[model samples]
Target chain A: MIAGIPISKNSYQALVLSVLGIALVLIMLLSLSLGAYAIPFSSVLAILGEQFGLSLEGVDRSAANVLLQIRLPRIIITLLIGGGLGIAGAALQGLFRNPLVEPGLIGVSSGSALFAVVFIVLVPGLVSGSLIQNLGMPLFAFLGGLTHVWAVYQLARTQGRTDTATLILAGVAINALAGALIGLTLFFADDSALRSFTFWSLGDLGASSWGKFPVAIALIGIPSIMLMLEYRNLNALSLGEREAFHMGISVQRVKIKTLILSALIVGVGVSLAGMIGFVGLVVPHLIRIGFGANHRLVLPASFLLGAILLNVADLMARTVVSPAELPIGVLTALIGAPFFIYLIFKLNKINS
Target chain B: MLQAEDIHFCIRQRPIVKKASISVNPGEILAVLGPNGAGKSTLFKILAGEISCTRGQVDYNGQNLKALKTHQLASVRAVMPQHSTVSFPFTAREVVELGLPKDSKRNSERNIREVMELTKVVHLEDRLYQQLSGGEKQRVQLARVLIQIWEKKPFPRYLLLDEPTSSLDISQQHIVLDILKKLKSQNIGVLIVLHDLNLAAHYADRIAIVKDGLIAGFGKVEEVYSETLLSEVFDHPIRLVRDQETQQILVSSNSKFHSDLKISKQAQA
Candidate 1:
């Protein structure tokens, strides 16, 4: 018998979390300090320290204002949304018992995107800071995302059992429907509206400001925490739903909670930062490969790695062209696509 | 006691498990022996509360199965299904650890280790579950369910398993059944669905022979394991061999059915 085997596993996961946590801090600093206007890393720290009543001298006003007001909220929002997507992906994958299942597969992204496009095309004489434009589009898109999940969930459930194959098929149907709707709305969009739609579709983390921070916390932060608390449930679920039910998990209820939580995360994320992909789908796989597939480890690690990936990608996106920021959506795919191909080859070789 | 009365299940108006009654008592093993597609698994599923029967009810310790919540039932019983697979790359040890109730705060590591040792899967702890052999995987899954009800409680508990020995070799099969037999001392009743008649005859305290969606016989081994009944339930010519000293019942089947071939011999379901 192995003494302290579980302890060793716990320590290993703790070590992984610590490393990811430290790396996230470093990446957050680097992302903050090195943007279109480069501030010194120490100054960025000092500016942040000043908030906590720590006395640090030689703080420039504009630099502090830019760092505190512009960069910090964006960073915080990115972390929340990115972490939300990662954990959501991991949870949804465990819920469905498929590693490949992502936030995109169940029509959350497409449904939200469809609603966003319709809002853009339909609401004429756009007002930037008006009450309707400020809240209307996001609310519409969020509802759209949630409604699609309900539709897909009902379609997949038969005889009180959620069939896995049918869930994916239902996703396909909803996605196709949403795709057609998006195409239909595109017909009414003017040239300028079309350009903005293309940009929004490509995704931008910069859309979030200090104004949106509180709502982002309410929408994404709470759901991510709930997902994190579901590690044990997710672990049991990966054994297959029938086994989970026998092992004391309310399988149907867990599935619904997981899907709804995932929808909330992705829905609000799509609202805040337009359709950023790949991090949700691939970050969990990377964590599983590096560490084992225990949800206790997978969900948190996916969250950290997701935040890191997005921050780094956002860093490059804003800096690569210098003042002309590339869409984070384009960069994530560019970064994520090649690495995914490489992973496929690596796994194939390992299997052979 | 775990009791199911007149349980009938139907799929699309076609009967699967029809009007079958069975009970598992504390301190004994009840083996459900049947040919493939004889509704053995479906019956197991119904008793395990994985699915609600179309008719009749299951009661565990006098509590209606439908009235009891899943977690409530879980504290009193554990189930090992016929087929199970993990989707992610969880370690075998991790998979086994899932059996521990989320709210359980006991020495779980020791519990998992002890159960792994009991199931003879101690060496496969660190190995990825997907990499284990079929027999190894079966044992691991058995350990998972066993861990659920391993710690003794005041009330009687039940263990329901379906075809646990199907993937195991002769020695491994005996090991698994021996573990189940040991549960009787813990006041835990075990209801196992098995294919091998001799194994059931050897270890089962009581036997239920299922054929064509109904139980052909249910009683003590001596009253149930007759040569004629075994042959009829299995639909093949059969004989029973007895060890001279041990008086053990060994079932043997060879040659075709005494009756003419029927459609039941073909694939059911």
Candidate 2:
């Protein structure tokens, strides 16, 4: 109904992006200020500015270390992972043309989780070294995620064309198999390995350091930006593959690009954050509901909102239980599942 | 300006369109009519470059359709499938705007409005595409395709539509056909698959009746709409009648019951 509004489409898009960007920055700053041993707002600002040579007196050293060294890196990782999942989810939904579809619906996270479990339980000693612990786990997890998505894509393809239903079904089967493999790994784990597996599966962001940020950015952030750039092709695809082809879009190339980009993003996010859930699904859905279904708007909006949502969620994870952080994944699923159900009902109502 | 030369498309071992050749000249409406499995849609796909012909080639303005880059080919040809269902809620205007070329953003607003007006879907532009009636959706889709090839260039353009009026009421069907007629006047070729022979007789400049993956009859309406040719192609008894006032040809079904009932009444009397 708002389609007939007098506002120009370009202006409306610019307005929405501007407002969302401002809100995201505000939420991010609030997140930086709301943790245990909370840094004062001034110190948070000063520490952020000090890095750019803005010397402000009265900055506490401990607060600076906590904000700059500890919290900032963790928050940055959370933002990147959240944004990555969000854009990936939006792209996948547009490609599939199913509002209910998410990045994880293609078995990327489960496959990566399976590999991470294998690393923890099967070769526990390999993860103890700093180099392997930091770099190796994420690399192997990315490869695992990429492999599963490729496998699913291959299965879903018939005569070089991928069907949405077939892809989703293949994802379901791959997830079940990966889950079984993970369970088997769990069964063979020793006590220490068992604890670590449980921690990793629940998504521990406590290992966040400046050292891991570059790898996460290189793996997830760049691919996510690439997905966002596919706004036009994704929008065309919403009409169906044949329509897209007729619209001058290379439908097959778009499909393959989106699939690989989503896998890389979700793969990297899972490896870095340990299988966080719901941000990808919920953020993009909410963006579509608020704005129109234009992918040009939806994809970037998803990134901003996804970052805000996870930063806020991570803030909650650190503060709610105090000193004992709840697994971010558990919180996300608890929040995401009900929201997803509500979205389904809303869609049905609108359709009816 | 659009020609499909000896197009043969097969699925595994079954031929869908075999050695079928059809062409549409600029400033003409060519209607393809046939039975359910007559392969009209497959031929349209080959002409629009949606699928490759298994044994032949399509040419637009003397250029091979397959060899042209997709975007380049799209500038000259636009296709509307039989049914296009968008799951998400896109406004009708947004759907129409999707047809605009990437480089024509500066003129997009004007083009979108003009096409919507041309298709008689300007009123429905504000409504969600998913919420529109079947006829309205078809019109919106038509507008979308029209916008795609609306730009004037050195070469001719083609519009290919598949069963566009299948869901429309009588007046809506005329509105669509009239729009195509107007487009034809602009020197844009139109290729349409129609189920109604009468509508084809009214609007089409040429008629091609397809039967079992082959062109059974192809020529001007007068040459192609003979009683035997149509009846044989559709596998139904059909009679071609002309209107007394306008001299328009109309097709009527020669059902067995019509003659049987007449004979029974005569016998009783």
| Top-scoring candidate (DockQ) | 1
lDDT for A340 in candidate 2 is: 83
lDDT computed for candidate 2: 0.85
TM-score of chain A of 1: 0.89
Q: Model 1: residues >4 Å from true position, as ranges? A: A1-7, A124-127, A130-135, A153-173, A342-352, B256-269
Q: Score the docking of each candidate (DockQ).
A: 0.81, 0.75
Off by over 4 Å in 2: A1-5, A121-132, A157-167, A188-191, A348-352, B254-269
Chain A TM-scores in order:
0.89, 0.92
Per-residue lDDT tens digits for candidate 1, residues B140-237, read 99889988987768999999988889877998899889988887888999999999999999999999989888989999999998878888888888
How many angstroms is residue A203 displaced in model 1 relative to the true structure, after the best TM-score fit? 0.7
Clashing pairs in 2: none
